[model samples]
Target: MSYNFKTIRPVMPAKDMINVILSKTQRKTPTVVHPGYDISRIRGFYMRKVKFTQETIHEKIDAILQDFPKLDDIHPFYADLINVLYDKDHYKLALGHVHACRNVIDNIAKDYCRLLKYGDSLYRCKMLKRAALGRMCTTLKKLTSSLNYLDEVRKHLSRMPAINPFERTLLVTGFPNVGKSSFVNNITNANLDVQPYPFTTQNLYVGHTDYNFVRWQVIDTPGVLDHSLSERNPIEMQAITALAHLKACIMFFLDISETCSYSIDQQIALFKDLKPLFKNKPLLLVMTKIDIKKFEQLDPIDQQKLQDVIQSENVFYSQLSNKSGEGIAQVKEKACGLLNEWRQNLKPEQLTGGNPNLLREESILQGVYIAQPKRVNQNRMPVIPQVIGKLNRPTLKDVQEQNGGAGVFSFPLQEHFLLENPDWKYDAVPEIMDGKNIGDFVDADILQRLEELEKEEEMMDQAEIEDPEEDAREEMLLNTRDQINKKREMIKEEHHMKMKQQVKLHRPNLEDAKEDFAKKGIDTTFLEQRAQKFAAKKVLQKQKRQQQSSDDSDDNDMDIEGNDRNQRKGRDALSRSRSRLREISRSRSRGNKKVLTAQEQAMERMSKKIQRRRRNEAKAGDGDTKIDCKMPKHLFTGKSGIGKQSRR
Candidate 1:
C-alpha cells in the first residue's frame, strides 16, 4: 500500500530455514550447566533455547504477512488488478498455510518444554530439547511451496506501477495494435513499446504529464479483445478492471488502417459492448494512426459506423498520427480542458466560493486601531483592609515639600535613637554642656547666618545675569569648579596624614624581648633530653605488654600438654563415640550429605586442635610492636664524613 514493495524479504528454502534455526540455537544457548547449580537455574537455561527459537521463526513468518498489502484494505482498482494477476483464493490459501505452520511450531515448543521441565538427568533434558527443535524444523519444511509462491508474488508486486485510483487519470485502451501504447509514449514520459505488432503492451504501463499545473496520469492498459467477460484472459481482464474501477477520462483508440487485423466494424462493436463502463465518465474517441489513412478517406459505410460514438452527448473525437507526431498535443490539451471543466461542473457549489469570512480588508484595517471599552464590575466596589485605613501616610512629594523644596531649604537630620532609649526622642548634643540653656546657644544665630548666606547667593546670581559677555561667564564657571576640586584634594591629604600618625602612636616596642633567656639567668640545656624521655617511656610500656602476652601463651601451651597426658585411651574411645553420635544428629537436622564415621570424626577434631596451636605459636613468634626509631638509620645516616666515620 505504501508503494515500496521491494522491501519485502526473499523467501528461505526449507533446508536453509531449518539450518538458520539450528545455527541460531547453538550460538544463543549456553554450552554448560553444572549439576551443582540450583535446579531452577538449570531448567531456565534449557527453556531459553526453546523460546528464542520459537520467537525467531514466528518473527520471520509474521514479517512476510505484515509486509504484503491486504487486498481488502487497498483501493478497488488495485484489488481487482491483483485478483486478475494472481487468483485471490490461491493467495489467501498460501498465507493461511504459513500461519498454520507457525502455530504448529508454537505448539511443538510448548509440549517439548513441558517434558524437559521434569527431566531427571542432563542427558534426558538434552534429548528432549533436540526433539522439540527437530519437530519445529520439520513443520517449517512442509511450507516450502507457500514460501516460494509468496516470494514470487513479492517480485511481481514490486515491478507493478504505483497507481492512485483517486487521481485524475486518462485510460488509454482499445483493441490490440490500435496505437494505445504509441499515443501514451507520445503524450507522456512513459517508456511504452511502440511495436507495429498487436498486444505489445501486455501489462499496465502508467505515464504522468502536467496539465494546467495539475498532474494527470495516463494508464496504458493491455488491449482488450472483443469477447464475453468469462472468455477474456487475465491480460485482457486487467484493462477491464481499470475501466470499471478508475474514475477517469477514457480514450478508446481506433486503428482505422485495419493494420491490427481488426475490422472497422469489429472495433465499433467492441465499443458498443463496453459502453456501460464509459457511463458518467469523460469519454474521448481517439482516431489513431492517421498517417496510414484518414477517417474521411474511408468508405461512407465506415464513417456511418462511427457516427453513434462521435454523435453521443459529452463525447469528444480526435485524429492523431503517432508515427508522424501530428495532432498529439491538441488531443492532450482538449482532453485536459474537458476534464477540468467536468470536475468543476460536478461540484457546482465549489464554484460559489466556500470561504466563510464576511469582513472586507479596508474595514478590518480601519477598526484594528479602535480602542474597546474596558470591562469592569459595576455591582461592587473594591474593599480596603482595616489596618491600612487606620494609618496616616503622606505621599513622598508631600514629605519632600515639608522638609525642603529642592535647593532652597534643607532639614537638619536628628537621630531618634528610638530603639536604644525611647524617652530620649531627640538626639543628645554632645557640644552643649549641662545647665547651659542648650536650645538658646545652639540655634540663636541660625536665622542670621541663613540670611547672610542667602544674600551672598543673590549677589552671585545677579553678577552672572548682569554680565554681557558669554566667554566671561564660562571662564568664571570653570574657575569655580577648579577651586572646589582643589579643596577636596587638600582635605583628602590631611586625612591620610592623620591616619599615618595614628598608626605610629599604636606601634609596639619589641626591643625588650630581644634579651636572651640566659642573660636573665635561666638554664635551658635539658630541653632536648626532656623531649626524647617522653618517646622512650612510651616504647618501654609497649615492650612490657608484648612480653606479658607471650608469657601467657606459653603457660596456655603447657596447660594443654598437661591435660593431654592426663587422659587415658579408654576416655579417648568414649569421646570418639560421642563425636560420631553428634555427627549423625547434625546430618539429620541439617539434611546434608552422609555423616562421618567414628575414625573420621576423631581425625577431624585432632586436625582442628593442631591448627589452632600452630596459629598461636605463629602469633607469639612475631617481632615486638614497639616504635623502633622516629628516623631510621638508612635515612638519617648521611654519606660518611670525608676522613673518618661518624657515629649517629
Candidate 2:
C-alpha cells in the first residue's frame, strides 16, 4: 500500500513555540484586578491561566508525535528503509526528547498551580504564574536542534516515492551511468531524475503500470559502486535495502559500450558482489546502448563474461537502446510475464478427492472457484398481466383516430393504469373479507326508512329558530360592560403617566448629592466606609453558606457509610429531600420580591451598569469623556472626499 505523508502537520521551531505560548498567555489573562475583588477569585484566575498555557503546548507536541508514522507499526520493508535513510536510533531519540519535555512542562504547571491555590495576595499569585511560564519557555528553547532536525526529516519523507512492496514489481539496479534510470523512464511513466553523469539518481523512485489489467510496481534505485557493503553510504544503501526486501523481477542494466567509464569486467564484478541479494528472485541481465555498439562488436573477453552470467538457470538476457527507445516494450513484457508465472508457481497446488483437513491450503485455494448458480423454470414464461405485447397495445394515434382526431376529444389520463381483471373495475362489492366478496344488503322497505329519517331532520331544524327580544337584551348587557372596562383602563394609564414624570424630576445624580454635602461642610468618609463594610459582610455570608453546605454533604456521606452497597439509593433519597427544601425556599423568596424573566433581568442589569458608569464619570474628573473647547474644523467637518476622483 502506497502512503501519502503530505497531510502530516507542519512542525514549529522552538522560538516560534515560545512566542506562541507568551502571546496566548498575555492575550487571554484578565487585564484588571482590585483589592475589593474576592481573594479566591484572584487565585483561581492566575492558576487557570498558567494551566491553560501548559495545556496548549502539550496538545501541539502530542499532535506532532502522533501524526508521524511509527517504525514498528509499518511494513518491515518500510521500517528498514526508514532506518537506512534516517538512522532509527536518532529518530527515536528526537521523539523521546520531546516526550520528556512534555512531562516536565506538565509537572511545572501542576506545582505552580498548587502553590497558587494557597496564595494570600494577588501579587504572590501573579509571580507564581510568571515563574511557571518562564520555566516552560526555557525548556522548549532547549529543543531547538531537535525540532529543526525533525522538520527537515518530515520534508524529506513527504517527497519520497510511495512504493508498494506487495504488488508485482520490477526493480532496476546496476553501476552508475549504465542506463537503469533510462530503462525505467522508457518502460513506465516514472519521471525519475536522469543524467549522463555518474550517480544522478541518489534515492529510490517508483511508478506503476498495468500488465493484462493487473497492476505492477516499478522501482528505480540508485546505482552502487564495486565496494564492500559495510563502506557504502546511506544513499548507496537505498539500493541494497530495496534489493533485499522487495519481491520483484530484478533487471541489472549494463553498459557494454564502455562509454560509462566502467569496464565490463568491473561491472560483472559488481553484479556478482550483489549476487547474494538476488537469490530466489527472477533475474534479467539487460545490455544497454545497443545502437552504439552491438554485442558482437565487444571484445572476446567482455562478451564471454556477459555470457557466463546469462548461462545460469532462471537468468534472462535482453538488449535495449534506451536513447532510440528500441526493444523497451518487449523487455517489459517478458519481465512481467516471467514474474507472473513465478508467482503462480508459488501458489499451493489444487487437490481433488482427498481429506480436506490434510489439504487445507489446497482446499482454500480451490474454494475460490465457485460454481455458477442455475436459473429455474427456464422453458416457459409466466402470464403476467402487466407484460402487454406491442401488437396488442393501444397507441396515441389509435386513441386520437377513434375520438375524432384534433377536436373535442377528451381521454381519461388513467385509462391504461388499471392492472386488475377488467370485470373487477366495475364490480359493486361493498366489502371483501378473507378473499370473499359481498355486496350491500337490499331490503324491500329501505325507501320508507330513508323518508322517515329525512323528516325528523327537517323538524329539528325548524324548532331551532330564536326570538328577537332575547337577542336585544343580551346585546345591551354586553355594551354596558364594554364601556365600564374602557373607562377603568383610561384611569390606570393616566395615573401611570403622572407617576413616571414625577420620578424623572425628583431623582438626583450621586455627584450632585456629594457636592451639596461638601458645601454644607459635611465629610463623606463615613458613607464610603459603610459601603466597604457592607461588601465585606456579603463575602463573609457567602463563605458561611458554602461551609454549611459542605458540612451537610459530609454528614450525608457518613450516614451512607453504614449501608451495604446501597449507598447510592440512600444518597439519592437525601438529595431529593434537599432539593425539595431548596424549591420551597426559592418559591417563598420569589413571592417576596418581583420575579423578573430572563429578558427583563438582562435589561435591568444593563440599565444599572450604564447609570453607574455615568455617575462615576461625573464624580471623578471625567476620564476620557471630557471634550476640548478648541477643535480642528477641517478635520471634524469637511466636504465629503469619498466621491472625489482626485482623492482616489
Report the C-alpha lDDT of model 1 over 1-648, residue by residue, as the tens digit: 125667777878778888887788778778678877777777777778888899899998898788887888776777787789888888989888988898999999898888878977766776677778778888988998888888898889889988766566889889998888888888799987788788788898889999866678999999998899999999999999999988788888888889889999898889889999988888888898888899889989898778766786447899999889999999998888776656645442232122223123223423455365667544667798888876757655666688776675554445434466665566455554664555656676889999999999999898876545887888999999999999999999999887754444554333332344346443444444665797899999999999878866775667766666546645987999999998877745576565565665776899888679657655443353445468888988767667584210
Relative to the true structure, candidate 2 reaches a TM of 0.54
Cα lDDT computed for each candidate against the true fold: 0.78, 0.82
Best by lDDT: 2
Output the lDDT of residue 172, model 1.
87
Candidate 1 residue pairs that clash: none
What's each prediction's TM-score? 0.53, 0.54
In candidate 2, what are the lDDT values of residues 1-648, reduced to their tens digit?
Answer: 456677777899999988887777778766577766899999988888898899999998999899778888776777888899889999989988999999999999999999998999988987888799889999999899889888988998888888766667899999989998888887788888888899999989888888876677899988899999889999899999999988789999988897899989998889899999999888888889999999999989888778888785448889889999988888999899788667666643321123345256444643565376677546776686665675678878788888898675766555555856765555554456665554344578989999999999999999888979989999999999999999999999999887754444577655677787678566666656777799999999999999879866766666445454356767887999999998887755465674555665776798888789778656453455555557878768867666464210
Evaluated at residue 510, the lDDT of candidate 1 is 31
Instruction: List candidate 2 segments past 4 Å from native.
Output: 28-31, 345-648
